[model samples]
Target: MGTYETAATLDFVVDAVPGLSSTTLGWILVILAAAFEFLGVIGLKKYSEHKTLFNGFIYLLGFGGAFAWLYFSFEYLQVSVAYAVWIGIGTAGAVIINMLFFGESKSVGRIASVLLIVIGVVGLKFVS
Candidate 1:
């Protein structure tokens, strides 16, 4: 779909869900979107390694859910602010999850950088 069509659909969805434009709901949706974004990245990795139809389907579901939630969140939050926060959460969450679960690096500098991303995300939310 074109950008206009996609935007219209997002509007419709937001309108259909009453109270979704509330600050609490918007934040919840953004957080959920971030979680799904992490899941989507994990699915991408699995798909790359295994190349299975199931993995690809999981990836699509994760990404689709992430975008849908993020779009709904924009009804209440500024798009630029919301997007940056969402991406920040996703990036940090992905790295942390990988470190804890996937046995990725646990270096101090890497941990500190993730902490900085979290701080940035919090700052953006506060300013917005």
Candidate 2:
């Protein structure tokens, strides 16, 4: 079979599994991208504290992986939706990580703001 036809056939076969589709796979990639973004954020924090080749490598690897995963997700999701969701998750996750691990502020307002961000991300998922 030709490349396009082979790919379509594979997709059809994969889609036969319950609760798994191209769109589902796309969302999965988005989540993975966010996870890699978190890794990048942590690497950034470490690199800021200490300038080292290893830390720099970690930072580059995390961010590069994140972008690669996000790019692939675009094939299965709307560009706008994918980009926004990715940013939203990354932003909120970074805030939380800072608060938890970096000893940043953990005040009620900050917590509430994080909640708002989470809600907004969920809303986007539903609307799109």
Candidate 3:
């Protein structure tokens, strides 16, 4: 479908869901994108450890889907805001996931740093 048609369909979908607006849907997409980013990061780590088709598939699917969702979000949000939020969520998620599953450092400073990123995202949301 063309961009216009896709956008119209997205609007319809958002309107069909109770209490879900375009902006809210956009934020949801941003979060979804970030989730996929976690998978991508994990896949990357795994691929580095072992050269396997499955890991390569995971890496491609995760990053590709993440970017697709992020693209959809831009339909309802400003590019700058959506990008910043996406990056913030992805960065924080990757760090936490690494710490939790990959045996990365879970230092207080590291957690605090993630918290700072979260705070920045929230601040951007409030201002925009």
Give Cα-based local distance difference scores for all models.
0.85, 0.87, 0.90
Instruction: Encode model 3's per-residue lDDT on 45-126: one tens digit a residue.
Output: 9999998999998998999989988998889889899999999989999999999999999999999999999999999888
Q: lDDT rank, highest first?
A: 3, 2, 1
Best by the lDDT measure: 3
Q: lDDT tens digits, residues 1-128, model 2?
A: 65653121225534677868888888888999999999999999989999999988888888898998898788788989999999999999999999999999999998999899889999999998
Show the lowest summed lDDT stretch of 10 residues, model 2.
5-14
Stretches of candidate 2 exceeding 4 Å from the true structure: 1-19
Residue 127, candidate 3: C-alpha displacement in angstroms: 1.7
Better of 1 and 2 by TM-score: 2
Work out the TM-score per prediction: 0.82, 0.85, 0.90
Candidate 1 lDDT over 1-128, as tens digits, reads 54653342345545678766566667888999998998898888789889999999888888999998999888768899999999999999889888987789999999999999999999998987
Model 1, which residues run further than 4 Å from truth? 1-21
Q: Which one wins on TM-score? A: 3
Q: Which ten residues in a row have the lowest lDDT in candidate 3?
A: 1-10
